[model samples]
Target: MTTTGTTSKQREQATRKTGSQSGQPIVAGVRSDLHTMLLPMFAEQNEIHDLETVIDGCRIRIRSHDAGVRIPTFMDQKIMMLLAAHIRDVIQSGGQPTRHINIDRREVIDLIGGGGSTGGSDYRRVTERLQRLHSTKITAETAISADVSRRRHFSWIDAFEEDILHTDKGKEVIGLKISLSVDAFRWITQGDGFDMTRERFKSITSAQSSCSRIYAICLANLIYAKGEDVYIQIEDLRLRVPSADTLKGFKKRPLSKAIELISASPDMSRYLSVSLVRKTEDGFIPLDGRAPLESVYIRVCKGPDALPSINKLLPLSETGGDTRSLSAAESLVELLTDRGSSAFTDTEMADMS
Candidate 1:
């Protein structure tokens, strides 16, 4: 699927706007447990099977009909944001989920951060996406007690209707209403998920890969759910990426690459403090171990004040306006040293250097 330049820009702009709003309602909080909702970057072209992952502690597994696991693309994710934001708004207003949520076609476009009138190619695209979202299936389970547990199965939406109206401006699908599946409604209202802020959403949308987006979201979920800095094992991060189990799916090297991308991005680091460390049975292991890199760790930084020292280290590169061999290693060493035990050791530092 080759997305045209126009379509790609639209996606990026919509994502950027999500995090720009002020104190907005639920911009669509994906259920944290639905870890594999979005398909991986490399495998987006293929059909996904029974994708599964364990987010936090709950296990979430998804199986689609013959339609195959609909890997929620960037645009599809925006649709989710709209649904999530609407549900969040409804809940905050002390209103409950009705049988159907009616939205003006123009309103829908605005909600999704798109401009221009809602007609032509834009309307068709939005309509098709809503249908696709409705058809995707998922099953989520979490333990209730030592002997009790709960299971939920449903699609992202149950059904949708396009309300056509003939107005002076000509015929148009002025209104669009989507019926929420019971499970989707329940999860939106009662389940646990990250309350994505405009800034956080912007960061996630701006990320370059499936793993990078997953890493950022998981980190946000941890902070939101725990109300403090959280530590997630590297294995947990690896599992979050859909189709990442086999070598063809995803591997440790790609996982390392993903973590590295997050660490390198200034925008991502603003909302979440990310770092990669090695740990073994004996506790924190030296990076020099011939043992392959096991996992990456992530944490959400609490305040803007936490950034200055780390920011200062970037200037140490002294590249003299050259593009290649910018002494990234030297800067990394300084950055890690500043971060203390939370970053790599001398051996790891040399390896990176």
Candidate 2:
């Protein structure tokens, strides 16, 4: 694996050069299936021994390698997103991307919007989050089509090494050298992925509240709905999104707060609209205007501008005509839609909030 680093001067120069470019920021592609199924949007303090849940038809199992290590949190997911953006840049530059990547600590700080300084707290935060990502295990089993089913076992980071230098300055922490698991690498580089603007990504990741971060990701992935509404059971959502709150608490506070934030943000609302609803024998009813909190589902509808262009759907390849590209696109749609399992009647759409 090749290790790379940059001094503060070099970083400044790179930043200036990036700014001088055509003003179009790089777009990162995150694997649709993994984002929706494997990654949890909320943070957790308690150690997770073994967690198993089924989303759509896919069965997911998560475990921590050590008793002390916790599952990857929303912050960890941000790091993964940054890494994915870097990999995309590499591929676009005609460079062969690898699982082992070296990222400067300063770069990570910038991504997380932790300001320019790489203070002790920032250093520890980056290193500890990388360690947690390295220690967690994830296995997902889902059908690709009517006939094909696949099971994959992988971690976010297969290995992590911190670059430290000792000299007249005593000791200097350089950066991080991490090896992404093979599955993770493929997911970013080859799988059916969706494009997210770097600006939008930064906005969501840098939010103060974890709920806002979680809601943004959930809403962003709903672009696959193609301007249609997606109704997910509240219980099912609680299962996928790791939260400390009970189901009732989740519905009352975190979920509501998230809805408020997303609704208020122009960047988020430009692409999707969200609401809470109750499913009944006749149809779905919008829970609005002081309605009592009850068992309800989240209804996410894509906005007019939410669909991706043809170019965004394909992976960054030299020829841009790889056979796997089509399969990837198809797989993404299949996995996210739950293969019709979550489908509802048009009557469920009346008086949508």
Candidate 3:
């Protein structure tokens, strides 16, 4: 299906660029600035799955569309990630944020580390991912304006067109043209949604751990704090990050290990400092110390100026308990999940001090 009501790809002179540069920025198509309004795309091992998560009264839902009764409906996170990388590049490259945009297939393959894979296989995978992105539906219901709750329903991309080359060996993908849906475009255009730094985002491209990338995305939308920190239940975090382990297995090592990796990463440390912790009857304890594992907390430190400013965002206090009405972590969630905008409600801001 073709897109309507907006501009598509304005053909540019195809510039030949080769190879991946380490630490170069990759723009993810579905970035909500640093706020995680959209659910994660996939876990480890390239699993195709469906998931739903709700914060406050808002729901971020993703599901696949399948006509065949025999085929299960799910969105592959790898496809979404690859497509996000391409879309990010296009927008950063000065292309218009219309539904339609063109990218070289080889560039996508290179971006996703498809080296050594056969051309036919690469082409097949890219085609399948595009189809999934086009077919999958995403629905988000949250406050888009003061006093009015809006429900946004749209696909990542409305429709796609590809350039194909047939040779004696097999069919090869030459290029792709895709259109961003109306709702998706609005989300990108609204507020400070696309305000992430390219350097911080590019760090994900070179990092060895996928969880580190997830940590960075989560950090982008976080409320800055000195000591008072943000927390997520281990199970809640497991759902947000893609992993190969079962929920039970993920808790044992992978989750903690991922947080440790982020702590040690220099590229990631530039933006924020993170540690895995658990809250106890006594108080919140760092997992690195001799704390018992119960509720897992991902503690995010104050990030760089590249992130949204404290003046415009909800304040997370450095101290907690009876001294403050709301803990920093609780306030952070309210900032993220309340009105689709990152700022707090008037009453909420009044309660902060």
Candidate 4:
């Protein structure tokens, strides 16, 4: 029937969920049927478009709404690949992933929590070291103006009356300004996208060093996805993360709930901002944080899919078997689900130590 909230073009921007019959995949949406049937009994249950041959083998039905999921732009996806590659490299080198690092900036700031008590001493020292390694400073400014340019024109004024005639006015909606933040991390460099973080660490001697190494690597990636620039204010700085913690085995609470509990404490929330973002077929892009317009400094984008029913998010392999192909949705899900926790959180620092 009728869909609301999006223009025709915007609605059309929504992606198709059905597959073509290539005879290779088990998921029907990826394949096309030799004989096509067009009628009522087409799509899978609770979906708007079946996007496949009405068959029993492989199938997918995508819900059609006036608006569908919006994805990260090309540059962001490139950036995501950079982040993912760096993360994978670190983990492969025997380092703990970012998820495994448990110190918030505050505990990091005050030097208290190392995510738990078991490894507290190790976490405390290592985190302090990492803090010194990746320190950076940033400043951003937003400008406004009332002038029009060659590519822009002022609109004609209408409905002027003698009783209320006055001078017509025009204004600039947004002006370009610069945000100055150091390069704490680089996603793409010199025709290659991987292994740009070697300089951020001091030589990791063991698993402990590796854990801290990966933690810094994770934060470097996390900082970029939030639309913030990562940089090293102090050169030769290193981020230290302890290799051990007792809470590593605990089942995770809902990510949103964790962010809430963290942010609910005014002091704790001040450590970092949290949000849930989506991973696309190409790469992971962060969702924005929830903050008032005037008060936030550094924003941390955290959590998994901002969308519901991630299980249904398109996978590189619609059949849930193999993923040799590229499906943007599938790509994203794999990235965010890598550690099971879907969010990335960081802080607006007073200054990196």
Candidate 5:
């Protein structure tokens, strides 16, 4: 867990160039299922004690280590993405992939844009986030067979061992040997995932607030979307994000603020366009004071700088003969359509936030 001092050769090995450090397009493999369902939108440290809910007919239960720790937030999502990218690189290089992987702590901080300082405060925070990811447990319902249902229980990480290096300056964490839980490993390495550029991942993780980060994550996951416009009901979105904000508050603040941020980013705007819309008897219309806000209309297409790897991530044939790729929004629409309902009851809405 700790080392007295690192030799020059050791330091060189530790800092050797991975795909990310080489300035190549870092393509991160991310679980669409987990990202679209498990992560919370709000970054507030709210302790979740055996919280259980049903999302899209799948029962999900979340439990933190104790009242002192919270479930994985947007920040942890960034860490998971980084780990996924590392694992992908390992597999592509013909290295045997496993649930356990090694990571350089300093390189991680630099990649996620945490801060320039790798001092005690920063290291402590990073370790705390890792512990939180390891301690929080989740059980989700899955269908094992045509008529059989099963519940899978797992955590983001099973455990981690830290490598502390001692220098004349001070003691520092040089690396980590992290073991991903069974479900987490399967989710990341399996074919049911998406690819994202390293720059986009960093841009989102370093976002100023939870709302902005969550919005960026949602948009980035829409890389596979094949339509000109995709409509998502606001109520359904609120539940998917598991946001604490009510419909009015969510629309006025987080949703609106995210739109503004995305619009201001020239690169982001070129790839994805987002706007508010209202539903009426005729069809979907632009948001105005006249009608109530009902849904968000999203248009996602490959920009000039988009990597070719994105197009190959999800093929229509893989999606069970569906002509268009099923983005998170499209998937939610299908679930809602099957249920014949989109609005949540007052009690259900209150419980979600």
Candidate 6:
């Protein structure tokens, strides 16, 4: 039986505020054994036809259905099928999976092809604006405007410099992912490895240091087809884009933590906000079906409330201890909001930097 649960308690504990007073209910807390409800669906689904094999300790079950697998109808079949698919997954793609990464600055480089140009962007102009803002020569608006104009230069590059700007012209949609130690220099110098034991894969390198990772990602998104053949470099760093847009008709292996399975008929997933978590039987449900999932994930987005005691933080809370709830940090933000000109201008950021 496969089981999954929240590894952290940080998800719950919400604090909400109505109007004048902020409520303290604590933010959402990730319940332990969140996998309890999830594992059974995988293990005992009734109609699981292919049960001959097992992999990674999970029983293998594979079957085809005319319509979607109904949870109550083919419970066993679903479980066993999902298990077999899971095994096939391990065998086919290798073991386990890397969930999330620390999103280090180097990961940014890795996205753009570490040892190559960051993007086809004119970093020269961006840098010049930064220098100007730093010396108080121009306003932040001027710098950001310059940056935006420079950004405007980005478009689908024609077949001209396709060979040279291959890495810089688009966002490198990742298909494989791995974690690296938190050293940008070493990670950049020697490059991040796929398999540290045998050094199975070498990281990509970038041609320049000043290139922006965003540009590379945008470019890579356009150019590369799929797989490790498309490599990128930031400086000396190299790595494969480990993400890919989920393919069509691909039945995402049902997750043990999946509490709900919303179909593709008219996906309402995209219409929702990130703060709206799909309360499912599975902890993390897959948005795999004919139509793309456009669901908003809430519940999980606790930090957006920030420290503000009003709308965001308050809504999550029921009742509050006003003294403890009051935030000096949020107070500063509230002051800024009251002042109206809230956004940090590019010039201001550059000057501060």
- Candidate that scores best on lDDT: 2
Instruction: Report clashes for each candidate as comma-separated counts.
Output: 4, 0, 8, 32, 1, 96
Q: Report lDDT per candidate.
A: 0.47, 0.61, 0.48, 0.24, 0.55, 0.20
The parts of candidate 5 lying over 4 Å away from their true place are 1-53, 142-150, 165-170, 213-224, 293-353
Q: What is candidate 4's lDDT per residue for 1-353, written digit by digit as tens? A: 76544343432332121121111211111111101101111111221221222111112122222233121111111222223333344445666433111112222222212234434355344333332222211111111235521111111011111111112232211111111111211111111122322211112211232222322333333433443432221111111111122222111222233445445533323323444333333333454544232221222433332211111112223233223322332232223222212222223222321
TM-scores for all candidates?
0.58, 0.73, 0.61, 0.18, 0.71, 0.15
In terms of lDDT, the poorest run of 10 residues in model 4 is 31-40
Cα lDDT of model 5 by residue, 1-353, tens digit: 75556676555555453211322343443323334332342233345445665665766677787568777665666677677777767766877667787776665566655446666676677787787788788766645469987565667888988765557666756557788875566556543445555565456445555445445434533432332244456655555566667877877776777777776776566566566766555455677664554544322334444422332222334324223323422443233223224432223334455
- What is the Cα-based lDDT of residue 195 in candidate 2? 55
Clashes of 2: 0
* lDDT, candidate 2, 178-243, per-residue tens: 789765665666544555665665665455444554564455446444456777666656655656
The alpha-carbon lDDT assigned to residue 129 of candidate 4 equals 32
Clash pairs, model 5 backbone: 244-353
The regions of model 2 sitting more than 4 angstroms off are 1-50, 141-151, 208-210, 213-221, 288-295, 308-340, 343-353
Q: Give the TM-score comparing model 6 with the true structure, all chains together.
A: 0.15
Better TM-score candidate (2, 6):
2
Two-way lDDT contest, 1 vs 5, winner: 5
lDDT by residue (26-77, candidate 6, tens digit) is 1111111111111111212233322222221222222322233321211111
Candidate 1, residue 50: Cα displacement in angstroms equals 4.8
How do the candidates rank by TM-score, highest first? 2, 5, 3, 1, 4, 6
lDDT by residue for model 3 over 1-353, one digit each (tens)? 75432122212111123221212343343333333322344323333445566654566666667542111122233333344445455556776444455665554555444345555677666667677667677666676568876555556678877654444444544456667665444333332334333344445444444465456444643543222334555555555554445666776676656666666767655556666666555545677655444455555664443444322111123112242323322333344443232222223334554
Ranking by lDDT: 2, 5, 3, 1, 4, 6
Q: Against the hidden true structure, what lDDT does model 6 obtain?
A: 0.20
What is residue 37's positional error in candidate 6, in angstroms? 32
The window of 10 residues in a row where model 3 has the poorest summed lDDT is 6-15
